[model samples]
Target: MSPRFLCTLIIVLGFVSCGLPAKRREDKTKCPHVKAIRNFDLHELLGSWFVVQYFASSEEALSYGCMRPVFSMSSDRLEVSMNFTYTFTDDPAAELLYGNITWEIPNPSRPSHWVHAEDTYEGVYNTYVLDSDYKSWALLLHCAEKSKSPRYLSSFIMSRQPILAPNVVTYLREKLPRYDIDLAYMFPMTQTNCSNTNRESGLDRDTVRYVIKQSESNRRHPMKRLHKP
Candidate 1:
């Protein structure tokens, strides 16, 4: 072969080799398993839930005992309101705090939802799974997609009180490890007061009582059919 032709052939082969696609790398990290329960009774799930304990992220400022978020159920969605107080160690009395949160359903068809503080466009998206019995505990995983650090996320183990029953709290604490949640900075809402009247005024007391009793009955006898609205 001619030297010029040989050089041209070598150039062509090198270009083709460079153009070949690189091998695709497999992602070893397992995606989070978001468990979903088939039956979630919204009525029993309603009412107010105090921030029992929460797992804090590095970016979150240490909250004073005054901060708490309340959850209540509407017809089809959940409403969340957060109120908090912040105090610096150097100036304990110079505390500053603000209150804000979004109340919306994940979407009628989707299990996930977005919770915004003031505007719909801005807020964290959450994936939640509730216990089968709706006894007063939930797992919340929140991701802030628009944050400066795109991968920012946090998890919380929320309950109805600052101190849950020993057995129940132990169960919840144990379950956190299975979900890759860190319990090191778990802050309990020790100073917050839980109000029993919150749920009474929203729905008719008689109606709420009837539903709770019916739910209890359904649980007792699984064979019986529970009417769904």
Candidate 2:
């Protein structure tokens, strides 16, 4: 073959190689695998979860407090309650703030919700990504709205025990960005008591059970001890 022809052939091959289709790649190093949450069981999902790490830019400030949030499935809808200690920076005296939430199933065919707070101003859409095994730990996503950008809203590292496993922490860090979350400013909760117990029935665990039981009791006539979740 002629040298000129050979050079031309090589150039063509290089172009073809460069243009070839490759698997779509994304920067998911810090994101969680969001698709894994699609199969969550609603019946087993009702309970309280404490916030562990949260993205700064999201509505975490108002949501952050001694008590985080509790989720329950009512019929086909989701009922949520945000419980937290509200401390005025100026006052230093802390007061409790509780906000209620209700979310309808996103699509009739899907178990997801376009959740909003019961109060209008505090409304935001969220998708529950992770449900605790016994409804213990949960990971919530603040999906982007028509007027907003995508964000990782709330990440709760709840457990039957107060403190979560170090492995759980590692898993959360690894999985969040796979769902397009940015964790640059994600903050951990300061209430160590909720995250430092060894017994499964410690403060964190009991808090979750008590909250659910109380809600149920309020609805039902008398108190009943159901199986621990």
Candidate 3:
């Protein structure tokens, strides 16, 4: 079989065999900080999503270039993972970065609204799907408390395909106000060169070690406040 066809088959199989959600407390807020899509299907959200445009602040813009968000249902919660390469300077060689986070439908009644707890980081992400068609595009908000003192906010526009349609971009731009998201900080990602990179099955070794090391060290440091910095 052709490589393209094989790749397509793998994604198709992934969607078909996506795991079921575990029992969790349902979130029942009619109007969360960000509006979530009504009657969203968690099952339909399995597989890989390409981020077309994203908005982030200076504190969070550590990496860039070709980010593909992958989702799968774990034994209890929805597992999210991604691996990308970024360069600190204009160098040809880039270093790989792995991200891992888990989510739960805090309120099953509101399927589009979810909560994120990172395995490798120090923040709890409140995620809301503003819109999705289960096929083409998805607009998500990532809100988290950096610490007891400061908060962080960002938004992501993901698509089944790498390119976001002009109309879709316009639509999301106009809708940003309702969620209190600023378009001025938005950054458009580059996806063309990522097609050649090999996708890792899960988080790499360095990421795993970092998490373990942090968790151990955090024992001494009071966990009273999970600082975002």
Candidate 4:
């Protein structure tokens, strides 16, 4: 196929995968989380975190590498921002990609739970800290819901370093099933060669658009998990 056709197809696929359908279907996947850690310390949670593992209801495969997010909290501790760097797992060159996500704490009493501050979506999107020890590891859950559409859910096992103890990982994974997460779909993120990825990022216009578009599309209509049991 010609480059033009391939690019056109990619654009079309992005819309089909990410765009909401005219008629919404009932969300089959179950996700439930009403509260986050009580009296959460914003200062302790601030800093850099390595995304050690990831799971999403729509994901068909593992997609990122060298995934790291440096977090910053506002003075009042009401807003938080994560400036992240990541590279596609399949990219031979491992060209870095960057993005940012900001969240607002709706309830000051529950500092661990937050809602998306940006209008990335039209409806409610929540991020809850299921568990965290501040200096070591944290388990986070995210759920996005649109009117009459399937809820999009994803989880992250993050650490202060590139690796977390297997026992700690086991302890963290146990909390997910109650929210309808399949342990099998929770895949580790590769951190090898990650030390240097922060130094650079460059891609052609078409390639960048495709990659970013596809990444966004995976939010709702992902293909499948990268690892199969």
Question: Which should have the higher TM-score, number 2 or number 3?
Answer: 3
List the candidate 1 regions with Cα displacement exceeding 4 Å. 1-33, 59-62, 74-91, 94-98, 109-124, 130-135, 147-150, 192-229
Ranking by TM-score: 4, 3, 2, 1
In angstroms, how far off is 127's CA in candidate 3? Answer: 0.9
Candidate 1: C-alpha RMSD to true structure equals: 17.1
TM-score for all models, in order of appearance: 0.52, 0.56, 0.63, 0.73
Question: CA RMSD for every model?
Answer: 17.1, 12.8, 20.1, 15.4
Q: List the residue pairs that clash in candidate 1.
A: 102-116, 106-113
Candidate whose lDDT is highest? 4
Q: lDDT of all the models against the reference?
A: 0.46, 0.46, 0.59, 0.75
Number of the top TM-score candidate: 4
TM-score of candidate 1 on Cα atoms, chains taken together: 0.52
lDDT of 4 by residue, 49-84 (tens): 999998877666887777788889888889988788
Cα error, candidate 2, residue 103 (Å): 0.9
Error of 2 at 115 (Å): 3.8
Candidate 3 error regions (>4 Å) = 1-32, 59-63, 75-91, 195-229
- Candidate order by decreasing lDDT: 4, 3, 2, 1
lDDT of 3 at 39: 69
RMSD in Å for model 4:
15.4
